[model samples]
Target: MSAAFDLEAIRRDFPALDQQVHGRDLVYLDNAATTQKPRAVIDAVRNFYERDCSNVHRGVHALSQRATVAYESSRTTIRKHIGAHDSREIVFTRSTTEAINLVAASFLRPRLQPGDEILISEMEHHSNIVPWQLLRESTGAVLRIIPISDEGNIDLDAYQGLLGPKTRLVGIVHVSNALGTVNPIKEMIAMAHEKDIPVLVDGAQAISHLDVDVVDLDCDFYAFSAHKVYGPSGIGALYGKRKHLLEMPPFQGGGDMILSVRFEETIFNEPPHRFEAGTPNIEGALGMATALEYIDGVGLEAIRKHEERLMKEASLRLPEVPGLRLIGQARQRAGAISFVLNGIHPHDVGTILDQEGVAVRAGHHCAQPVMQRYGLSATVRASFGLYNREEDIDALIRGLESVREVFA
Candidate 1:
């Protein structure tokens, strides 16, 4: 196997990285927030607007047919990407947040009764938390949190005891955005299956780094953001089993999601279309196909191997800064480091790092409860992706060392 990837070839595809930031060559460690798009994805969206700018599904004209074919073809592209059983199981949504809300609203709401529980992790993004809170409020179902240890890894022994007859659903992140913990989702899913409870794995952080197959995982549902996975914004997809998606109520009601309608009565369409409504984001979906294509070309194993190398280097070097402490030291972590420095607020660390031409995410990272659990308001987070290299990690260390020196 080749020990190298053509980094320059890969870097040239992202136009945003071609320029300077603060008079310095950009380091772009902010990938966990959103990835920079490839030229292919940009062109895919542009091509749709320039040539096939029309509404989808209903029009008999050529432009509409053009739009419909491109838009629907993207669904097939994504269905194959995640290895879902059928394209009909894929439903387009606004983003991961909207996708999770779709399941919480359409499926969980009706099935949940009083005393039924929604099991989620303490490390979940706020997107995973709020929807279940709404479900609890609406259905009187209890919300049970699977706690994490000091290193930010979930306690599986504790989680197993929580999984019992009353557990209606298990929603957990495939990777923790803040902690960089790659969750044991396959085992988690298998355990949930034994209990006869359905599971939904939030693949928002995992899709960029690992292979994802909904059928292989045997998950009841999976949700992830297109933007996070090198696709365009305002679009994402949900993979659900056909039977479950067919039974769930439509998350939103509008045109294109229905088979037939009247002023007096109406009927919704089959699984995928039943969940997608209104004027869909046709261009965004097309761009998602481009992003998926680019990722496939790079190969997920290559991406993960590169990221793991970066993480290994960072793990060895990060603790060397005087007064710096690392959080989330899970042995099975992906490419992230959430750290704190003595006598410096995480926000201050972020601002100072920004001034030094280094961009890193800081704060609770939408995992405030985890922050509170660790007695921290926040910590500075630096997450790695396929594009990152040893030089970036070196720059991060040098930047943090400057902060340590100045603060002292």
Candidate 2:
């Protein structure tokens, strides 16, 4: 691999990466679940709590004003990061799950009829699937799924066919968490737009791996989590077009969400704040902005190149192990690889890998539909990050060999 980036220097930024696990250096490959925090992000969170600890947008005190400024500035950072037209279009939520549920409840539910349909893909995480299912039950609407090929790419022909008069909205994942298939979202958005349908992109996995411009993609709504990109947990952002935010109802009712409260009628706040109810994750938002700044300093293009090389190397070497079968070989993949041994359970594989200090996710990955499609109960998934090195892949390969010998 080309040394375009100083990998050692980059790894030093993440304090967690310097530790030892089970008598070996920690090879953290569970980045799809959540990335390790960098010192910059940690300091940002600590600084906020120590110096600017106050509730936002309400108090007239100096601390509150400073808190409000920092909190809103993070919103501006996120807005520019995603190329969103206005910061008012960005609504803070607890996580990507909450963000998707917010849109399903606030935007889709109010307009949905008994027979309306929500189109999603077969490869979606449960966060994307369950919310729409809840909406379906409430409104008696139907849920339609776009099938994926054996290679893990979405069947675009099937997706186009599924869209019809009853299709109220389309929700799709920008990248498959389990498979690492980067869906052609820009084209999918265009297809949906032709029929006057709005599309929501689940970007939890894509935001860190790719340069996501909500404006360039022309997606109506995009949701992603902070922790997926080396930020703190319990915070995420939902980006909606200004018009949609203006039209959508508040997902929850609370102190800051309302302008005036009356028993008979309540006047709600404007777009962004209307959706953000109660006390927000003030420190988390600041940390997420700091994380974004760190990513910017590293440069996303360099990160992408580095990770792609890692993925390619791992892909070629992993299947060479006895009894190992690589799953989901999409032509365009990113950041993750899922595999299963011929006679070994994924949990067992994960157990053995962990003993060797290689952490990987081994389960349905909250995407049961994907498991059902592939006719497997689970798979061992090792997802990469920018801080990961070539040695991590080598360690994983050696660990898998040990697993094979034990099973043999």
Candidate 3:
């Protein structure tokens, strides 16, 4: 956070950043997909395997007890990080995708019925859209998409018109993975509450960039993957309000999720544990906690400010390149910028950028409907993160010189 925060020191923690992609330093801009883990997170993961390794919640053995403490301690750490009122409200799932699926399966599928509408914005990722679609297919609930404005933000008045007595759940992304538009979720959540419709904030692209207070947002459920926030893959969290989690049925049936298992009847455990089935990824959870600590230590506000500077600087400089069209000019955004090249296909641009050792994401970014909303098939996206520097965008610009030459 200070002016003394060393970029080189932070970059050194990520071993992957030291590699050469194409005779150049790998300038990775795909932070939205998964952030490179810091040395702290990596060490935390390694420590688990090296010293403590055992199944959690069921063992009195020394190894099991140590592993269980590390794993559950991670949950406690995260609960405080996200401002959840209770630790039991936090459910560990494989990733954000699985977390959303848990809500769709255990909660929405049971309560939703024919003619009920599940409202979402056009900008939701495929994970958010598909799970609700699945619930629709099973329960016959209509899926209504709130439209986006020309500026790439959701039309809130349109959303209000869509919400009514029949509207059951509002599943919207807090930040667009494709557009990088930060939705006014606090307002949206309040509106949904006024109408008694529960809202679930898909925070995959948000938690890495902003502080999320689940109680303050007042959303029924919020889901995000740890890997997106500089943690390891195969780990994520679902934060559900205690009342909602208590009412919802168990997501998966297995060893830890049950209180007592019988051939005829299996009683499920309480919230969080009820949804977390099987022997959990113990190391991943501990590493995720360490990852949050890494952020907390550096301070999330500072990271946000640094990325904001990069975004503004990149936005100002990039438009100078001819035939480069910036997409998603929302008033509030974070960590990502989507753009289209005049004559080059998105894939072609990515291929050429890779030649310069500059990596960027290309495609709809799992937001097919959002692409359709903006009348685009796909676009090349360069996203920023904590470790990114102004020189990174300069490298990105230098890489695009080839795209201009080739397309010209």
Candidate 4:
């Protein structure tokens, strides 16, 4: 542990980590899927329900005003968290999938011509891949994939070669969810910029673990989910360049997104408001902001150091297990670690670990291309979080022993 890393105190802030399952203390290693919410986030959600349960942007009542302030204030917090140029660039969405889809539908779909290209990496989640595929089917646009090395890192030289005049945009994952491979996004974005191509970063897996500055990175767009960052599910945000957001049409047409409506014609509102249609997730916005604040209080640098230690320990120890082969041996990694035990299916490994109170993810993790790259269908993934400790890794190893015994 790093100096002054009060692991116990950090663990206590998350109530879910204190509980047990199958009569053993829960060692949650499924953080890459969704992190357990901290008390601050939970409390913020509860307080909203108890006090300010009103729709924002429509109501004239006190509750509505309070909800509106809190909701929009959360947007400001998100804007600051990502270092976006303006709050107007941050549009709330259902999740990262919706955020990416928004860009696909509003920004790119109409502009892309037949035979135009959309480039993404082999390690992208389905959310990033499917939208481009759908765009291809609809508009006759071509979708190209940048292959990854055997170690799961995106091939920069290959990516540069693939960038051409017809390439409309590049969508890259900031971090690999299944492999924990952290892509050098800043460099990649710069390369795309040289070709005058916009880049969209799938930041769902990177936001909680890394220090993200959209301004510094100069990415055209960034998509991420609150659930992955210790906040509520069903809410996420997209940070688009102000220029792009202004040029793009609204993804959805509904109440707040319109400035005026008549039977004959309708006029739309400005950027963020235009993108966000209907009643927004008021409580969710508040909760996500609180989660961001909690992370700030803990200090991202400290959290980074702590998780680095855990990753190093897991790297050294997982290889010790019999017939186990770690996957995604990238040049750089963070968050999740995946491996397969010989003669054991990943599902079986995950199931047996669950019996010993170790919660992990199994299967393709929504990255079938990554699975295809390795010529495998699935692998077991143990992901980490701020609340996790080295003891959790020890417990995970011990649980694997149980899995081995069961199969034997």
Candidate 5:
């Protein structure tokens, strides 16, 4: 552990990490799915419901005023966290999936012409892939995939070659969920920009594990989920460049996304608010901001170093397990690692590990194209979070041994 990273103290911040499961101390390694929330975030959510519960932007009462202030304050915090220029660039959505969908429907759909291209990678989560597919089906556009290498690295040469005149937008994942590949998105974004193409990054897996600066990357849009970063679920944010957000139309129609409405024509609101249609997740935003503050309090650089160390340890030890085959040999990896055990179904591996109080994900991890590339239906994924420890990796290895014994 780094000198600044006090593992024991950090673990204590997450109340969920203190419990036992299946008669053993729980070892949670499924951070790619969602992370365990710290106490500060939980209290933020609870406090909102307990005291500051009220509708925002529509009421003048004290509770509503307080709620509204805290809610919008979160948007500012998120903007700062990602190094976005303005809070108006931050639009809240249900999750990363919805954020992408909003971009597809409101931003790209208007500009897309028949036979125009939307570029993405083979390692994308379904959230990144399906929206573009839906756009293609509806608009007669073409969806192009940037192939990944055998080692799970995106082929940059291929990516550069595909940025042709017909390409409308580039949607990429900063950190792959299944493979743990940390893509060179900054370079990729620059390549797309050379051709005057805008790029949208699926940052769901990157927000907690990496230092994301939207301005530094110059990406047109970035989307991430709160739950994956130890915040509440059902709330996420989309960071769009101010120009794009100003140009895009409203995604949904309801309470907050408009300035005025008439039966003939409804006048829409400005960017961010224009895309955010409905009452919004009031407490969720507060909790999400609190979660980001918690990360800041702990120091993101130290957390990064700690996770990298744990990942290196896991890399060294996991291959020692009998019949284990580590997946995705990308030179740069983040909080996720995947592998398969010979002749054993990944679901079975997950079940056996669960019995030993080891939690892991066993599936294609919403990246079916990645599995298809490797000729696999599924693989066992062990992901890390800021709260994870060296002992967790040991427990996972011991649990894999038990799996081997049972199968034998």
Candidate 6:
């Protein structure tokens, strides 16, 4: 009903939104986990398989050439999506986990010395935390955490203190998946640069909701997943500075990653090819490009405004429910909200919500450190996307009311 955006028209593009569950209209609020694909993205994947299915950068035939163009074109699209300087800076990976691991292994591990430090925030996902732990085990480097306040914002002063002469790299999430806290990445990156430390931003939860510019942020490394942005699974991208990608070693070695091979020595191809080993996810890349195009059509500024309105409405209404406690009250946030009901397990709340045809996520959200910080085992989460509307929030509220009635 808002003049700036037509919610119904936007909803029509996503076929999955027009469905029923348990004889009631489906209300999907699990977008922080993975987004439902738009029809354009789905058709792009199907078209690739139906007409242009072939291995990229290897075949000489028409299908192969077509597939190669589509695949590589997606890389270019993604490069522009994040405002990287060149397409070669974008390396395709299976997920954000792989991208971060690539940077941790090839970029940071070799450079680290005993007693060197890698700084991360308290709100990082396990993907951001565990890789550094593995690197620390191998190289004897120390991992230092930047403490977060009770409201879930990273303590800026604490973060500055964590940066010292021994600090080599900083890995932080641009947005908290569980708490929806949007970190001050630009400021944080500048702060780290003051100590000449490189920073890698985990943008998995941010790319879909915000207008991300790697050039503007001047981050050393940035990563995000396609599925989190209404694209297909099994494909994502890591955007590194040209200087870093050229210097870093390959994460995986296989066909297409090398210029030539022999018994003596294999000449490695330049990145992003060096990082993309084996047959790349050609279909996935094309589908992801279509998804980005879909987002572009909607306009990120419009999406941000719409989601902000929804967040404000939910913040006002959800608290009115008896015994429901909203967690992570950060002044700046997006995409999701985590909460708990007194005496009710999160799984129980999720199950009850499902009976009323409201889909949500229930668990630690792969951020157990965050749960530990809050002194809880798990919390129920409701995340948003472009297709979401006020009706979805209303449905979630009514479902919670039903849960309260049952518990009473």
Residue range 62-168, candidate 3, lDDT tens digits: 99999998999999999999999899999999999999999899888888879999999989999999998888888889999999998888898998899899999
- Cα lDDT of all candidates, in order? 0.89, 0.94, 0.92, 0.94, 0.94, 0.94
The residue pairs in collision within model 5 are none
TM-score of each: 0.98, 0.98, 0.98, 0.98, 0.99, 0.98
**Residue 227 Cα positional deviation in candidate 4, in Å, after optimal superposition:** 0.4
For model 6, the local distance difference test gives 0.94
Query: Tens digit of lDDT per residue, candidate 2, span 261-350?
Result: 989999999989999989999999999999988887788899999999999998999888877888899989998899999999999999
Worst 10 residues of 6 by lDDT: 1-10
lDDT of 4: 0.94
- The RMSD of every model to the true structure, in order and in angstroms, is 1.4, 1.6, 1.2, 1.5, 1.4, 1.5
User: What is the Å distance of residue 323 in model 1 from its true position?
Assistant: 1.3
Give the Å error, residue 272, model 3.
1.1
Candidate 4 Cα outliers beyond 4 Å, as residue runs? 1-4
True-structure lDDT of candidate 1: 0.89
Candidate 1, 369-397: lDDT as tens digits: 88888889999999887787788888888
Number of backbone clashes in candidate 3: 0
Between candidates 3 and 5, name the one with more favorable lDDT: 5
Instruction: Note the residue pairs that clash in candidate 6.
Output: none
The TM-score of predicted model 5 comes to 0.99
Candidate 1 clashes between residue pairs 3 or more apart in a chain or in different chains? none
lDDT of 5 by residue, 57-140 (tens): 989899999999999999999999999989999999999999999999999999999999999999999999999999999999
Specify the highest-lDDT model's number: 5
**How close to the true structure is residue 9 of candidate 5, measured as C-alpha lDDT?**
89
